[model samples]
Target: MITLLRSRRSIRKFTGQKISKDIQDLLIEAMLRSQSSRNIRPWEFIIVDDKKKLEHLSKAKQHGSGLIKGAALAVVVIADTNKSDVWVEDASIASIQLQLMADSLGLGSCWVQIRNRMATDELSSDQFVKQALEVPDNYSVESVISIGYPAESPKPHSKENLQYDKVKYGSFSKPFYQD
Candidate 1:
């Protein structure tokens, strides 16, 4: 688990190769297994592989979302707002689960944040995506995870570069690690 964590990196560039159906099934399994508060299981997912739709969704945000156009698969993470008050957190967990599974299966993935962001000066990112995907009312978009074989490989983050200061022991002042 630690090795996988140490090696996983957000991959934005992907090859032209397409992901196989077997691999895609595994990713779905990973997401469905995600633990949620009170087991409400509020999260749901939409697998987008249509080229035209992927290109359209690439513009769902003003920035940080163009990678979807190149991904072999893009999973839109959404949740039923009426099912749980913590739907955002629930959907977020499923998103990462999908990404991590992709990483483990020798694929690369990038998380595209959608909630509270903008598609244009006048449109909210969530609304834009919901309209494009035909998501039902009362459901909220949380993220879109783009997955494919990596066209570019990024080095794993080194331990020394980790922000140890960001972690505190019990309180804000004391350091979690002793030098």
Candidate 2:
């Protein structure tokens, strides 16, 4: 698990290959098992594989969403705000779990933030995606994750690249002790 976490990378380029149904199921399972406040599990997902819809979603945000057009599949993460007060946090955790599961299965994924964002057409990202996908009014769009076979690989982040300066031991002036 640690190795998988260390090596996982956000991949924007895809080979355009289709993901198997088994892999999709695994991703969904991972999302469902993610931690949620009060165990309400208010998250909802929309799995989009349509090419035309993918193209339209690629324009959902002015930036950070071009990858959706080339992905084999895209999972739209939403949360039922009425069911959970901390819906966004819960949905975000689920999204990360889905991404990690994709990495473990040798697939690549990238998260495209949709909440409080805008599309190139000047519409709010959430509103545009809701209209395009016909999402229910009760749920709010949190993010869209693009998944596919990777066309390129990114080097994993290493301990050498970590910012030690930001880490505090007990108080602001104290440095972390390694023993």
Candidate 3:
């Protein structure tokens, strides 16, 4: 499972290929299996396949550039604000699950932030996305995920290149594990 998680990378480029319905259903099931706070499961998914809509979304949403033209499908994961304070956490888990499932199924995926502070302000990175998608007032558009076959393999980040010295134990400056 860790290998699968580690192997999963954000795929911005995709082949212009369509995914099967059965695979889509399986991905949905993976989302459903994600754990939520107190079982609230305060997440809603909107799958977009219409070419026009996808194209419009690419211009509207943050990090949606490659999604519109490359991905076979785009999913909007919304969190019900009225549910609980942990709604965002729940939605995020589901989003990761969906992405992991896509990777396992030999598909590529990338997450586009939609409900962050940057995406909602006056100088929003994706103000047009909210209006274009017609997101409801009651729900927060947490993210947009693009899924499709990869056009080119993404280079993996090297673990050795990461700064592990900054990591600490229960207290600051205390090493958790010595190199």
**Top candidate (lDDT):** 1
Better of 1 and 2 by lDDT: 1
- Top candidate by TM-score: 1
Report the lDDT of model 1 for residue 40.
98
Between the candidate structures 1 and 3, which one is better when assessed by lDDT? 1
Q: In model 1, what are the clashing residue pairs, if there are any?
A: none
lDDT of 1 by residue, 110-167 (tens): 9999999999999999999999999997899999999999999899999999998888
After TM-score superposition, the amount by which residue 121's alpha carbon in candidate 2 deviates from its true location, in angstroms, is 5.9
TM-score of each: 0.96, 0.94, 0.87
Report how far off residue 96 is in candidate 2 (Å).
0.2
The number of clashing residue pairs in each candidate reads 0, 0, 0
Q: What lDDT score goes with residue 153 in model 2?
A: 92
Candidate 2 lDDT, tens digit per residue, 1-179?
A: 99998898899999978999988899989999999998999999999999999999999987789999999999999998899999999999999999998999999999999999998566899989999999888889999999999999999999778778777888988767443
63: Cα error in model 3, Å: 5.7
Q: What lDDT would each prediction earn against the true structure?
A: 0.93, 0.92, 0.80
